[model samples]
Target chain A: MGTTGGPGGRRVGRPRVSQRPDSGLTPRAELLTAAADLFTTRGYAATTTRTIAERAGMRQASMYHYVSGKEELLAELLESTVTPSLTYARGLLADDVTPAEGRLWELCRTDVELLCGGPHNLGGLYLLPEVRAERFAGFHAVRAELKDTYRQLLAATDAGGALAKSELDLRTDLLFGLIEGVILVHRSDPERPVSAFAEATADAALRIAGI
Target chain B: MGTTGGPGGRRVGRPRVSQRPDSGLTPRAELLTAAADLFTTRGYAATTTRTIAERAGMRQASMYHYVSGKEELLAELLESTVTPSLTYARGLLADDVTPAEGRLWELCRTDVELLCGGPHNLGGLYLLPEVRAERFAGFHAVRAELKDTYRQLLAATDAGGALAKSELDLRTDLLFGLIEGVILVHRSDPERPVSAFAEATADAALRIAGI
Candidate 1:
């Protein structure tokens, strides 16, 4: 995973002997984790690559071996956090067996779990002002796709005439909005357990969808 | 009000003679509006007093006559945006005639209107990374008081045992989460009307509260 023989490439630092194989984290994974923590707490703009390297227990030069730069690190963290849910949402949308309401519930539950159950509160990155820049356009595009999936599922559930065609778009927005609200609340009060909030948010998501 | 006899004070710029009395906005109010627009769109960190002054049609020196600095501009915007809602929530809490469920719905509707009906989307300020800083501690505190009001109302409506005591707090979080979700959606797609979204949200809030 090391970058070598590239422009501006230099020899990265040596790996630490203290790292154990059983620790269940690759050097790259450790860097991402460290980056997520700093990015969420101190914000993406305030955090430096050196700080991330120190947090991950690697030398500054060695950090480049695993990741290209700080922006890439943030892009990676956001993709890792959001892409899995998008993939799962796509899979559910393709599935023919489950009803739309059930699929929506599963999507809400899985999303809440991913957001609330993560070791670091990475979902808070969505609230960062820097993330809205053109450089992070890919992240916003994927996020919009995820929201589109919600719109699809919501339209499916509206087949019973529960919601008018005009209302589907707004309901979709409200549904995801309720689910993502947990991130903001969790940010404000980190000590509180997210399990209860996650459960209640999932329930609220379903209710918002009229399921 | 114009500032006079203050340190570094000077007649900063010529007043626009085109200004009319019926415009119904003071220079300070215009500054606040301009700041909210820039802060919400360009972000607090990226926005400067000069830019805010330019947007509000005043000189940078004159801008100081209205606000102490960018942080104070933000504090003012946040206080203006949130304090009125806090005051209204307090009034509702003090009122004995309205049932808790009705009060919650009213709160949801009023909040949505404030969030969505504004020309400049002031609620987006809540998403800025700068607002999380210690300087804006008062904003977060008052926001908590608003949330607490929701808790009180939710508890009052729990008379029939629809929700257990433990669920009230989480529900309050979800309740506000759902309402505030409108801000995020409005930020994404500003063209859509919020009235329908507000109506659906209020209904969903009541449902989440088990009313």
Candidate 2:
């Protein structure tokens, strides 16, 4: 659904899909919102297009006019959740923090914040079985790009001598696993906010990073 | 098909479903093995009774003669995976470790080994829809009991002054999340061995626990 805005035969930049629509004030919002709620609650396979249409107060056939299918609907949900967070992380890398350790801490906090600060649609994405198959294989590249963002942050830290070179990959995997684990725990109990988990995890991560 | 051999609802063990004269060893084994494979690969909803019977070189009605239904077959598969792991975990906990930290590390390591050691049927159980609705509902107490095992380890650590008092809950949640996350990473890459991931995770976890 994305279009490249570059010149003819140019392969420089991949276009980003406008998350919802040109105008955010449309019935498309209602349908996307309904799909997200059902997919997260009932799981993707268990959730049906007919049910989403009913939830959005529209006919089943009419819902497809707004979006392509359930897979596109899931893709849109993922994009709305992950793309902005990645953008925020990229922006944080250029901040005025002088030392790499400070930058690393900032990156870690922003990541935990992105995970803990919002509705956690990524949590549902990780939990979905239907979306895991090759039917949504396109999303894997997007996910890998997001993961590489973290890897780059680690490399930047190591380049600045803030993190040890002996254990970069191990550290990165642990941090990713830690963030995922915290998300699941928070999802289990909505009463416990992500901020508390973020602060504790960030503290532990900084200690492990020797920052 | 489990039976309670003792009074007060106490149980002896899993009942032998294939011991009857109406059943034969080869057919029952083939049916179960085929169901497990299908459930693991195609997922529960997509793997119909007819499909499983076809895979077993039999008819759906003959399959019913061996078992009650697909749901029961799934329950059997799940039980076969979960019960032995619980027993193994209990055995590991019975080992002599002086401090609570040592005991907890051993427990976490053993948990990782069990999940990564072989083909995980629990993956299908977690990813399956109906199992979450029907079978898992009955096993909630078992999960709670497993959580208590971790709770005891955490409390022991707290008693021994191995971890900070305020961070106990956060640590426990993170630990469990690490194990679940490692198994998930293993499932995503069948070509790669899980041992490397397990060792890396285990080392990072030891660091996090300040071991």
Candidate 3:
């Protein structure tokens, strides 16, 4: 959906597959929805283009009109898990007036909420070895940039002061790990309220930062 | 392999494929090695019995002598990841002398080290949807027991004072998550010395417990 390079884009509408009911989503959105469900519930490597197309209520050939293949669907799905947090993080990084510690807490809360609130545990896909392929370098790069913002905000915190660079880096590893790792917890107990879970995660993030 | 129950056990040796050199492993060990390699590198669902058998230098049908099939391999590998830590945790629970906070720290350090120091990021496989099948219930129960030990140790810590049960559970989730999540960090930089990484993880665990 980005203006530049990436394996995905918005494709026009198409006729439905007779066996499946329509979800009333745009062709591209519908494809992504189908991909998210299949990728998260069925193993990604085991899921085929034909199955995703069938799930989306479209013909296999028509699905190609919307997606290049499974890899593009994966690339886009992985990006979806991180892009919102990355965008908000970029904004927070530029805002000098807000206290860095509070901003860090807010970012952690929002990030965890988004990761946990999703109908699918899309963040779980981060563990896939297939994600290491060149096609996903874009998603990894974006995720790295978001991590850098966390490091910056943590460094600006009172507790972050006086720590050596190595220590800072280590804490950043734990902080970022905890943020993304909440998906496992959320998945185990899907009934947990997202707001309280987010707040708890933010509290733990601050503590991990040695607050 | 345990004396009681599980899908795995030691099997006798056998001749191997001509093309691949001997790994100097027992036939059962060799099969597991091949499985671990294939499951971690190529996606688990993508790897087949034929491929795993060939990689281990045995005929596909002969491979059945050491194992039932792929799901057994998956169950054993998942159990391997947690069993060591779980065993250690049970011992720690019985030890009344060591301070609870220190025991918690040591457990965190050891757990992270075991997870991150592996040749392959076996923890990565925990994300696979297939893991949730009823076949893996034993592995899940063991992991849950290990987590209960973490909860007990954490509740006994001085910093854990006066906390409600819900808050304690949230912190336990964060702590366990960081321990398993370190695999992501270690995977990105495989060269990081395990000792330093483990120590840093222990430090972060204590802080996350509000120390």
Candidate 4:
């Protein structure tokens, strides 16, 4: 058994630890990568520990040396994808005290560039069902916090007359809604660039604000 | 071996023609309802014919009496949801040659109502990985046709001076972007009424069009 880290940048449940000759890379890193691919393609429930172990060319028992179970594997996959992007997003916001519109544009760009870069498994996790129901509890809090950041931008725009006077709640939701919606479309059809969606949404937001 | 009608309202697959004496429901109906529940909750891949059969209280072998396989089940789910609504939408367009703005609103309302209502299992299908990859081959065609209808409406509005003069292609995509964005949001958050989304999107579309 190999002990592995869960997705939250921490150890989750207890798993048996097996000392393997370091393949020069951390066992945890290898396990996380294999888990991410299998989970992304076959989904969390459909992809068992055995399947992941086989994919990684390890015995079933040895697979647990790194991670406890499927849930932790899922947690690790989600956490790796979400936590870094979120940390970067916070930094982007902190570095910018520009007008709300500019800040919002930067936020949209950050998400698109982060999520849509390469043919990675991260995008699938964003749309996965079981992950959303179970492993996504932590991610949702991060998402809500990000939404608040967007709301602040919208509020600032309204105050500065960058947008037409509109209810803050509606504007916030609308902006959030468009961004999420665009991400979904881009995920579904990778050919569709996120930059296009960002521009269209930003234009709409600016129009609403009368900016 | 009991037979079952295949999914997608196909004329035949493995037809279990006999109605159960006490249940008064066809095995096909039972399977579909159970499949929908399971598909939405556990997700498509996590769901199995055996599980669906057991949920329907039929033998695993007997489950094949109703549908060919899971893929067909997905097709059936889509048929029940998208086909009728699209048909109704065509009818609405045929019946009323309203201005573009009005007709677009009708399209939005109709789309929401249809999605939220009958064959709601189709929504879950959209979230399925396999379905997302293959099943949506026809989706763009549906979207293109529906978009054409809206473009016609926009042309009428422009002629009437109710909307600003704009190129049809960009205007159509923008309109689509808003509506598509709203529908995606509604699907994610079932608590929000489709009507509310329709209103918000319609307002946004009108504003963007300068109607």
User: Which candidate leads the pack in TM-score?
Assistant: 3
* Positional deviation of residue B57's Cα in model 1 after best superposition, in angstroms: 5.7
Candidate 4 structure lDDT: 0.60
| DockQ computed for model 1 against the true two-chain complex using alpha carbons | 0.39
Model 3 stretches astray by more than 4 angstroms: A1-16, A19-21, B1-21
TM-score of each: 0.78, 0.76, 0.90, 0.72
Worst lDDT window (10 residues) for model 1 chain A? A3-12
- Per-residue lDDT of model 2, residues A1-211, tens digit only: 2243423432212222222232344667877877877776666666778777656555678878888878888877866655665776677566645665665566666666776566534554654545567766666666566666666666676442455554675566666667655555555456676666667676666555444
Best by lDDT: 3
Residues B1-211 of candidate 1 have per-residue lDDT tens digits of 3322223422333243223223458878877877887776666666778877755666678778878888888888787767778899999999899887788788888888788888877776675556788999988888899888888877877542466667767778788877776777776778877787677788888877767
Alpha-carbon lDDT of model 2: 0.60
What order do candidates take by lDDT, descending? Answer: 3, 1, 2, 4
| Best model number under DockQ | 3
lDDT score, candidate 4, position A141: 74
* Candidate 1: segments with Cα more than 4 A from true spot: A1-31, A47-70, A158-162, B1-31, B48-66, B158-162
lDDT of 3 at A161: 70
DockQ-based CAPRI category assigned to the predicted complex of candidate 2 = acceptable
Model 3's CAPRI class is medium
Which residue pairs in model 2 clash with each other?
none
Estimate every model's Cα lDDT from 0 to 1: 0.74, 0.60, 0.83, 0.60
**Candidates 1 and 4: which is better by TM-score?**
1
Model 4, residue A12: displacement in angstroms?
Answer: 28
